[model samples]
Target: MSDVLAADSATIGEPAVNISIFGVFVLITLVITFRASRNNKSAADYYAAGRNISGQQNGLAIAGDYLSAASFLGIAGAIAVYGYDGFLYSIGFLVAWLVALLLVAELMRNTARFTMADVLAFRMRQRPVRMAAAISTLAVSLFYLLAQMAGAGGLVTLLLGVSGEAAQAVVVTVVGALMIFYVLVGGMRGTTYVQIIKASLLIVGAFVMTVWVLGKYGFNLSSLIGGAQDLAVEGRDVAAPGAQYGATGTSKLDFVSLGLALVLGTAGLPHVLMRFYTVPTAKDARRSVVWAIWLIGIFYLFSLIIGYGAGALVGPERILAAPGAVNAAAPLLAFELGGTVLLGIIAGVAFATILAVVAGLTITASASFAHDVYASVIKKGQVTGNGEVRVARITAVVIGAVSIGLGILALQAGINIAFLVALAFAVAASANLPTILYTLFWRNFTTQGALWSIYGGLIACVTLIIFSPVVSGAPVNPVTGVSPSLIQDVDFSWFPLNNPGLVSIPLSFFLGWLGSKLSKERPDELKSAELEVRAFTGIGAEKAVAH
Candidate 1:
């Protein structure tokens, strides 16, 4: 173990630790959590915060929702490893917010009383649509939660020098408990405030780090590119020796697939969509989306700089040996260039980023269970106020436990953080996005269509992913013995794109359209659908109230 540490230090250098920064972060988080708890009241307050959140606050929360562990740690790691291709993910992520702003945001705010299920079931009976929506929401949220939990575990273990399994268990327990407290005690009010604070700090930290990196390299674009090119060549030789790592042959296809997944997948994420609903009015929802876009765009731009900086400064060989463990790349760079204090600041910012994201995800999942499933479905819309809040709190605990369990399991599988995140995005885009989009925009969309699209797309994506050659330990070919098949003689050798969004997204649309064509429609239901559309478009609200 000592020799291994020595070798890692030789390659990656020794990472500096600052316990004081961590202590400061913990203090701030607890304070925010306590403040949010004071605002907790009835179920409405807990889940939607009485639908009274301001546009700016909600926008900040949306940014918080968007910037997850994947965005922070995974993107940096990707750029460090894959060069320009990795930055493509950041661009793709930013572009998808455009779809959110123009299409889904105001419509979701106008139509749904609370969750995504309200939008899906706006025209039809609640049971079938709510059940389908709940399944999709929970599935996507849980998958995302697992990825975040795994990331947290990895970060904790790396920072504190603890055993991996023990670190994972600790993260699961701590994050899970905090999440429950956030939802039960503070609800949406608490979650929203925490997200806003974290998002602001994250953007500030990233910008500071980016500027410092640029100054180090003299802010010359050509020089930076030259450095990256030289480092890519040298690092490739050092790591794989004679192996190419850029957009070469099949890898180009993988890049496009990944880009498609990230771009389209953002529109479908339940947690992101839920943030828009917290605002009071549809106009605020629209405004919040615009703000979120600007914020996210700025952050992604910073991410590109940080990624390149990591590639040039840290090198790929050092990043790969412990990809999941390195949380302080930006801080380490700051320390090497600036000083220890800057490193401390960056560490605090990263810690806040993790906590804010996890808290938002936990609240989103809790809402799905408490409101969408229990109050809206099982209780037949009879639940109200404090009872509903209690259920949400209970659901938070359950969801947190599940996330912890999956985080522990992920450690055993040796999953990379970025890969897990991509999987979550693929599932979200494939299953949830199609149903929500069609339900809002297409009047002819039927219950059968929504159900088929949600379940069919989900099953298809998961099935393809299971058989895809991308699974880390996927069985080796009997003859060639390579884990990922490249030859035609192998049993499966098509679609080198590991992410299913490129294929599954279109398939979901097709399934939805086909299902709508075959289903029977009632005249009264069509009238109700028209009314819902008018309401969502802001034309029928007064008349809707009059009736």
Candidate 2:
């Protein structure tokens, strides 16, 4: 902490690039937001873009929302530092989409009007089910958004030659403001447009970076392969997994837990699920998932070249010289290959990536608060038209504000934003996935069962994380000399694993089943069967209204 503060002080007043092309991105997105606002005339327009998004556009948007700093930086950085272990993260993310495609994308589109709660509460008790689902949505979205904001803070330092808390706070505030603007004015329409643009840029940038890296070695496959395993992993092969997954002092069960969280968690992410409602029909939603699968899959393949190139080119010392070097690898690689000009462009794409994703997350949080909590549950559907939109916009602003504040605090505390994101995935998998699966497929699933799954899962995830090694206490910090977990004074973590998915996920399902059996409370058999028909066949799904 002192070193970072000293570094922050010493690096003060360094000159940054006089003309950041990133300004062009800000200008372009704001114009898109203004244009989209003119079309947002109703609640439907605000929340789900009147369900008019095309499969192709929505696919890009989905990829934009999904690919975070985690994708562009963390994975690449991990690979640069840890050899083959880092590539596992890419697989976890890409394979998760399969679960989203098979279990969620089409069914969620058929069942929900706007949010995840609508699907969970379709045949169950509306108020309790909506409330529980709303809490999970807000939790997952807020956690994910905080990571993006923190990444933004680090990025601003890289871009502007500014370091320290103040610069980070300033960057976070500006990003928060832009995010709120996208959600308020552009709504889903504006958000999706930005997401599509961001995704397109990301794909192109990644492809170019990969080609440039290959060209660096005269396009020799042997050179590429030989040089990529440059990072030495002790007691483990550089070409095999060990540096991270199933490494020394780590359990294989932990590996399985992390994988489970990644695979199941994507299906339960509120922002991703909300994208389904933005499309007009089940077919469009399904098609969008397919499109995202291909685009994101191909995009991740480029990470290898970028990651390995960094190890072979940039090296690790310069990366760690910054506060969070893990995120700096890819950007540093950009600078290495194409100089400051190209670095600025990649930074701009990263800024857009964060903007689009945080907008999606904030809008979903807002909808969960307004649509599910206020409109449906609190007002019993009395709120309509501008009233609902007003609540949603206000909620979006609040979410952005809260996320910025938390991002600053997290950075100051020296928390790993990527690790925080992993915990969030665990929470979503534990707290939300069980309820979604039960409500969608189980005939005897009752309202009590849904509530049990939601709240019980939520509680389990939070508790396990608090008691886990990530927060309570780790044995050492390489720089600090003192332990750096949230509770620095105590080594109270009985749970060896950082991720809580293995325990929490199964517990949630078990609680759902137990609650249903204990109460002898049966769901509406007719409604359950109707949901099966509606979800699978789209017999009476919500349709896009005339715009």
The candidate that achieves the highest TM-score relative to the unseen native structure: 2
Instruction: Go through the candidates in order and give each one's C-alpha lDDT.
Output: 0.69, 0.80
Number of clashes in model 1? 0
lDDT of 2 at 37: 85
Candidate 1 structure, TM-score to reference: 0.87
Candidates' TM-scores?
0.87, 0.93
Clashing pairs in 1: none
Task: State in Å the error of residue 198, model 2.
Answer: 0.6
Clashing pairs in 2: none
Across residues 1-547, which tens digit of lDDT does each residue of candidate 2 receive? Answer: 3433332322212224412477788899899889988998888888888888988889999999988777887778777766677777789989999999999899988874888888888888899999999999998888898778877766666766655767667766876787788788888899999899999999899999999999989987568656755543334354677766775556577778888898899999999998998888888998999999999999889987888887777765556556555667787788888877778788789878888888889989998999899998889998766898899889988888999898776555445555667777888999999999988888888988888888999998988887888777787755335454655677778788888999999999999988888766667888899889988988777541331
Candidate 2 whole-model C-alpha lDDT, 0 to 1? 0.80
- Name the runs in model 2 displaced over 4 angstroms: 1-19, 228-237, 413-416, 477-492, 543-547
RMSD in Å for all candidates = 4.8, 3.0
